[model samples]
Target: MSSTDTGARRGRPPQTPEQAEEVRARIVGATARVFTRVGSRGLSVAQIIEEAGLARPTFYRYFANAVEPLHAVLTASNAGLVGGITSALTGTDEPVELGIALIDAYLDWARGHGPMLRPLFAELHDPASPVSAYREAAFDDIRAAVRGTFTELGRPVPSPLDLDAALHVCEYVVYRISAEAGPGAQPDPETVAAARLTMIRVLLTTLGTRADVEYALEVPGLFPPPGDD
Candidate 1:
């Protein structure tokens, strides 16, 4: 028989939870590689099976379809990104500083998840992808975190619509920043710097009071310090 159908004929099923999880991770990692190379449009079970070095039955043992692995990858990513943003909020209390920290957290995650970020960004609007629901929930989590921050500071929390809009703006900006690069590539320094500045402005306007925004503009080095560009 061909390798494609031989998994059942070859080795035993994972005897331990750890081994099962490891195998599952290999499938997820292969999904990410497929996304990086061809994006969602080109993703398929066959592609993932070959990339993961698994038989069809082997893949099916852990996942139900082509989309589950993609969803699995995104679930992990959303948790990490939202977690970072929440952590950023806890480390600072100044309104403008909070804006800075929030944006920095996003950029850090994007940079660290470079291979997957581009596809995740592209998947934002893919009707066939499960990314839309996941994206909405992830943003809501961020909004809740931001609201908690303002409540802790005794400041009025921004409206839900406003907070969501600001994040969409940043998402669009980063989408533009990384659009031209190939999968697994990062945008150049200049592009990332400019995108960061744009996002910071949108966020400040949306999340900060007028006085806070004004103070942000007047900060000589902190707002757009040397090396920021």
Candidate 2:
């Protein structure tokens, strides 16, 4: 018997939840690919459906418009970054250590998702775009994580405006570095390393203190050196 026939004969096959999740993932993945290629302003529902190999009806069933899948992707990415930073910080309360961990987590997430994030960043400031909502939600999550870390460390929590500014600076630095280091940019590894170090130092200094910044610099490999892979 054919593999499909044999498998069907053996038992009932897939269920709705698993199949639905797989379909949703495919839609999101396709949306990311399309956004990376054409950007948000140029994106279309038809393009996404074609990329996902789904019917138009299927696309509508899962997402309301081109922006919804993009929102879902950003939401998942932000949740993952927040979860990682939160878990990594469970027992530590030192300001420098917390700052380093948070910066590391943020950079790692950016590196992994930089291409996927480019379009979202482009649309982030547009109040009419769904990506703006997701963008604000992401910053909120990061701010909450930072506040919690400061509380744990017995340090004064930054005002919401201050936290927002710091986080935006961190994000812009990461995004700029990632764009320069992308496929054909051919940036020197040392330059990337320096950028990372500078980012960590600035963030720690802004959110914590000069002493915390100095301490982070002294801890070797606290910021991963470039080309370390």
Candidate 3:
């Protein structure tokens, strides 16, 4: 029997969740390269299939279209951004240390993903594009994580400097530092932490204690406690 027919005749053999997830991951990774090359407007299913080395018809088994898999790629990429920096945050008692770790992580992730993300952003921000939803969702996740950290820290819920705004400022710092510092610039831990703390202090003064309180409260969420979620 043909592979497709044998599979079909078995009344749909079960795939372990792990197995299914691996296939999905392969599809997502391949899509990143395709999207990076084509931009959102130019992206196509055939292109992703060609890049992925999969049969064209089989692409439908994993994704409805190019956009669906693109969302997954962006989501995984964003999660990695947060995960990359959390380990370096330890052994520092000051809140500024945590902020520095966060900023440092941002720069590291951006520098690595710039090529993939730069084109993705260009396609996403185009006025006529549907991919903006993915971008907005990613931003919302970042803001919520930041806000959740603040809320847990016993800080006020609303401030001129909430997680949403802090994210923008922090992202700009990361982008600028990466831009001007050059690829070889190795960030100084103490200095970065201190600079971040200063920025945090200014942000709090302008926006009020609510923001700071929230940061302290939500820090655990940002960097979860040992062995616990």
Candidate 4:
């Protein structure tokens, strides 16, 4: 038998509740890695089992199919990202500062979760996938967070800034730019970070005041220095 088969045969004793939860977490994490690498259309249960280093029986005990674990990943990831964005925007009064803080929080989350986010973004449009619903909920959370920012700053949202439309645009821009410059794109992290910041500035121009746009441009760390780029 292959080593994998051998490992499967030597499975551990029955797991306690905490141990089972840990196993489930491992399976979900492995599912995210496999899904990120191959996408949902290409994902295979066998691949997840291999990546997770778990016996087939063990996997089946926790999940009925690959989609289940994927749903778990999406739910957890979206919650964490929304929490980070909300925390980042808290206490920021200026529109420009809010925009900068929002984008910075977004990029930081993206950088931290690039592997999972890439495929999550790619598969977000699949209607049959659980991630589709999760994506919609995430957008709603983002919209509320953005509107709250304006409310907190005592500024009325401009006519041009439809929170829903702006949220969609932000999602599209971030996903597109990351997909284009990610991994094999050969751009360094700083270069990608700068590009993301520039895109946020453009987004701010559409959703924010002229003064906000100008202030964002003047922010020192928003983008790389002229000589660096």
Candidate with best TM-score: 1
Task: Report the Cα lDDT for candidate 2.
Answer: 0.72
Give the per-residue lDDT of model 1 (tens digit) for 1-229.
8554333343356767877887889899999888778877788999998898877777889999878998888898899889999999999778898898899999888887786777778788777778777888898899899998899999998887888889999889878877776666789998888788889989988878989988987876446554755
TM-scores, each model vs. reference:
0.87, 0.78, 0.60, 0.80
- Arrange candidates, best TM-score first: 1, 4, 2, 3
**Between the candidate structures 1 and 4, which one is better when assessed by lDDT?**
1
Residue lDDT tens for model 4, 116-166: 667777777889767789988987788788777777778775443466555
CA lDDT, every model vs. true structure:
0.84, 0.72, 0.59, 0.74
1-229: candidate 2 lDDT, tens digit per residue: 7443321122232257766677778889998889888877778999998897677777777789998898777778778777877776664677776666777777667666756656656677888777777778877776787787778777888887777777788777766775666643434567666766776676676787767766776788755556856
Model 4: how far is 219 from its true place, Å?
A: 3.5
RMSD (Å) of each candidate, 1 decimal: 4.0, 6.0, 9.8, 4.2
Separately for all candidates shown, the number of backbone clashes (residues 3 or more apart, or on different chains) is: 0, 0, 9, 0
Q: 2 or 3: which has the higher TM-score? A: 2
Looking at model 1, residue 163 earns an lDDT score of: 86
* Over 4 Å off, model 4: 1-13, 158-161, 182-187, 217-229
Q: Candidate 4: count the clashes.
A: 0
Task: List the candidates ranked by lDDT, beginning with the highest.
Answer: 1, 4, 2, 3
lDDT of 1 at 114: 81
Model 2 is weakest, by summed lDDT over 10 consecutive residues, at 5-14
Stretches of model 2 off by over 4 angstroms after superposition: 1-15, 182-189, 213-217, 220-229
Residue 161 local lDDT, model 2: 72
